[model samples]
Target: MSNEQPPSEQPPPDTASDRLLADMLGLFNRYERETAAARASQGDTNPYDLAPYEDVHGVTNEYEAARDSDDPRALDQFLDNLADGFHLEDVRALRMATAAVQAAMGRIALAARERGMSPDRIAAETGYTASRITQFIREEKQRRAAGDQ
Candidate 1:
């Protein structure tokens, strides 16, 4: 038999794509943990209360799917749903999660910019429009500038 190892047995190569995927998963895990903590701190008795549904049954699975996906928009959409109502805890959690995820995306975009990636390129990779990518970079720069003052 050949000495070649199977894909499952082999270690993943340290490619940019792999790094991005790892970062995504890390961010998702943080989102889940933080959201749960926020719920607990707000005295939410039900763990599935943040699931964005009236019927809490089986919604944890749907929430997990939304939070643990490779697509960042899944989490964004989930947060959107959460923020759609007038619940104070849900709004606060959504705001916190949105800020955290946006900060991470900003850092990634800035790193790409530092590496000479154009807005169009970053947008293509991030699934955002070039104009929006440019706007995000501008906003991040302003935030840093404000922090320097």
Candidate 2:
């Protein structure tokens, strides 16, 4: 008798093994997707890429020179250049308001001194040097005198 079986009498499919294989494939695909997302979240990790260092407008010669220089002041100048180039109106307004507040404080100090508050007492109360307090009072008096003329 022949040992071969007829094509119509095939063995049953291994359903358990097929399900396990399908599950493994799904897990592998999920792992690949997660890995790709992690890399994307990390952004460009290459140190050789200068794209991040370049300004949005363009790479200026001043920035390049500052970056290449050994002087510490060059970095300060570079920062100043960047700040001057990108003028935030809100920051400018805040700086102006700060100046106005300082002037007002100086005037108030002068008024306090005019009300018989000693320079030493004013300095101790305001956390300023006695000489600085005296200077502020003198300046205020001079300003008043100038206005009276």
Candidate 3:
């Protein structure tokens, strides 16, 4: 009834908080894209960069332990730390995936330890079937032998 433009005629708009959040999200998205490109260019997906974790709460050893723990919990904790430290949502998913694999590996090693259980036996029960539990055991041993304390 008035001369005012209809709602449909109004231009799309962004609020102050909306713009702030969008800017923040964009910054993180750019980082993820860059990191992904870096990994792809290297032909690897290791996800074990010791640089970013450095200088952040002195968690260097913790992160390394998580990587090598072969324990699911370790991987989860590692990813959580990374996400919390960097405030990135994508890393949350990466953390879950990493934790699952490591946990399965840990179970495999544990299965190999059960009574008279060969590495194969352990793998069968644990669903990993690494077929070379010896290698896992050996690596674990070496890691322990090196005074991981």
Highest lDDT model number: 1
Ranking by lDDT: 1, 2, 3
> What TM-score does structure 2 among the candidates reach?
0.36
Clashes per candidate, residues 3 or more apart or on different chains: 0, 0, 1
Write one digit per residue (lDDT tens) for candidate 3, span 5-69: 77578544479887787678879989987897788688743333544434433465567688899
TM-score of each: 0.35, 0.36, 0.29
Tell me model 2's lDDT, rounded to 2 decimals: 0.72
What tens digits encode model 2's per-residue C-alpha lDDT throughout 1-149? 99877746846447999778767987998987777677667873322233323332243555667888999799788777566645467456657876896787669789898899999999987778999988888888899899999
- Give the root-mean-square deviation of each candidate in angstroms: 16.9, 23.4, 17.1
C-alpha local distance difference test of each model: 0.76, 0.72, 0.65
Task: List residue ranges in candidate 1 displaced over 4 A.
Answer: 1-99
Q: lDDT, candidate 2, residue 24?
A: 90
Model 1 per-residue lDDT tens digits across residues 1-149? 89989867967659999979877987998998898789878986454454454444444565778889999899888767655744887657767876897777777787799899999999997778999888888888888899999
Candidate 2 Cα errors over 4 Å, as ranges: 1-94
